[model samples]
Target: MIRVAIDAMGGDLGPRIAFQATQKILAAFADVEVRFYFDPQHFTVPEGASSNRFTSVSCSEHVASTESVDRALFKRCDATIFRALTDLAGEQVDVVVTFGNTAAMVALTRYIVGLLRPKLYPALIREMRPAPLKCLVDLGANVHCPADMLTGFALLGSAYLEARSDDAANVALLNVGVETSKGSSVIKDCYQMLSARSWPAFSGFAEGFELFDGGKNVIVCDGMVGNAVLKASEGLFAFLLSQLSQHSMDTTAVEKLVRAENRHGACLVGVKGNLVKGHGRSDEKAMVGAIEYGIDIARTNLSKKIEQKLIQQGVL
Candidate 1:
């Protein structure tokens, strides 16, 4: 059975969404076991959580979203997040899903369970455009990455897709324009480096317009630009929806594509185990999606696949 450790004390609503989602997940997935770490004073165990598959561990303390990463690791060492990570490190859990402070989660995962292949953390973001679905790496993990760092992100992203696809995924570097002369020297050098690789079917440079066009399955960019693009797209979508709301249009389709709850979570690529960071303000539906996403990662053995590919490429 797949075991998942959840930080029930994380996120804006603390343990409420986590508990609600846990109830749904437990009902839907019979083979999965869940360990919830929460502050006992704040959270009450639900009747549905009494099953053998569910385990609740009450934590004395919790970490706030605004807490500094260093403080969260040291001062709040006994926080629910740390308790969940400790369980994961001890091999008591197969995966961890949390809607906690992103920076703290990243820091703790690197310091505790360890990084497997690419030492740098890459934010794994998915594009749901039905025409052509794709994955984007380094959405907001590393703001200022060098050429080598971008190369590492590419490897991590390709390895992730490799876990799901029998055929090689077409990888591309995101640029302002399709021309190699359009980007900075770092991007140009990264282009040269990726073009020299044999595996991953490295396609040439891709533009912003091509992101939703479904032309490339994997797009690599520094966290700064990628995050900006992601937020911009979200904001643009919201603005358009607000403007068009007066027209009484069926907006569910468009909202589903760019909503925070729809994306739900981002995987911390390069980690040794499955670790998904759910949105801090996620509702029950989003948390459920995050947990299921972690389950998908565990079932696919994404970490092991990435490690093997990295070893084969002499990258580990």
Candidate 2:
């Protein structure tokens, strides 16, 4: 059975959404088990969440979305996210899913679970739409990455896609212009480093407009830029949908498509264990989607595959 550990109190909606999601997942998948970590003093699990496959652990503290990583590490060691990562490190669960502070989660994961490649840091990768196979790496995990870490993101993103499919991933650096000389010095250095690699298909720099063109399987960038791109895309989607409604166009089909596209959560790649981070404002449906994403990653043995790839490529 696949075991999933959840930080029930991580998101903005509190533990209610997590409990509801757990109930839905338990009802749908018979072979899955879930362990929820939350503060019993602040919230209570729903009656319907009781199942042999379900377990609850009490955690008195939780890191807020605005909490700094250092403060969380030193002050709130008993937070739900920390406890969940501890369980994951101890082999109590196959994977961890949280919608808490991204910075805190990244820090705590490195502190508790450690990295697969000691020299490399973890990056958040998420599949994008219009081209479902396309993915963007470093979605707000590391705000400032040097050239080496940027190349590492490429490796992590490529290996992640390769694990899910038979084809070799086509990687690209996200930049303002497609021209090789266009980005900052750091990006140019990353481009040079990636160009030296012979395994994965390294397409040259990709402009933001090329994201949905289905040309590159993986787009690499620093966390700050990637996070901005993601938020802009989401905002644009919402604005366009609203405009379509104002025009008296039927938006039902578009809404369905958006929902389907938004199902998968971001994966914190390069870590020793699987950790999926959902949006902080996730509702029950999105929370369930994140858990399902974690289950899929767990089943794929993604971390093991990444390790093998790193060894074969001599990345470490």
Candidate 3:
């Protein structure tokens, strides 16, 4: 059985969404156990939570603070990630899912769970946007990177999206242009070097806008560019939503629900521990997906694939 740690106190629709998602996961997956940790802002697990054959942990103290989180992630010394991981260390849990602050999530995972350095290093926020939907690594996972590190990102994105996108061979390297002679000497050299490699068949270069509109699957780039592209895509997604009111076209419920779910989740890649990042404004659907995504990571053996590719890229 896989144990999942969920942060109950997170996102705009906290308590309710977290609760509903937890219920859905537990009901749908019998082999998976859930552990919820929340402050007063989010509801404690219902009365039946404890005896329902699952584990639930609660902390009345609020562990999430917003003001400082934008610049830095929430403190995980004794709250949020740390709390869940404490239980994990004691063999009380296997994976952690939360819609809290991304920085905090990154920091906690890096500090507490520990990541492989030099080879297995780098954390990435991967997602699929509208249009073609590609997975861009190091979104908020790291702020700094090198060519070697970016190559590692390439391998990771490939391993992850290949499975998620139905083995779509649409991987691309994000750069200033689609041309072979684009970007700095570093990127050009990397591209030339990569053109002759044996891994996920390279899909060539992709521009910032092409990162989404095009049907690229995996986009391997530095954390800085990846993060900027992420923010840009997020801004556009929001902008499209805000302008939705101006449109007179009839919208389907599934379309609306899917767009809603997209806002609140990003994958936490590269860790010995199981962790997922969700939107600060996540609702029940988003939180629930985070939990299930973690389960998929575990069940699909994502870590193992990452290990194999990391070795291929000479990162391991």
Decoy 1 TM-score against native: 0.89
lDDT (0 to 1) per candidate: 0.79, 0.86, 0.67
Best by lDDT: 2
Tens digits of per-residue lDDT, candidate 1, 64-145, equal: 7888666437556678888888888888998899887777777788777888844455565554342344677776767778
TM-score of each: 0.89, 0.95, 0.78
lDDT of 2 by residue, 25-51 (tens): 888889899999988877987666657
Name the 10 consecutive residues with the lowest summed lDDT in model 2: 68-77
TM-score of 2: 0.95
lDDT score of residue 183 within candidate 1: 87
Best by TM-score: 2
- Residue range 1-316, candidate 3, lDDT tens digits: 8778887665677666787888898899998887777765446557766745466666645446363444233343446556886665455677777776666666666666666554555566567652344677777666666666666677667766654556655667788788776687767766765666677677778877765566666787776777777767677756666577468544455357556445345666666555677766766766777787788776655655666656665656
Off by over 4 Å in 3: 40-43, 60-77, 89-91, 117-119, 129-133, 162-171, 192-196, 212-216, 231-247, 253-264, 309-315
Error of 2 at 221 (Å): 0.4
Estimate the TM-score for candidate 3.
0.78
Candidate 3 C-alpha error for residue 74, in Å: 11
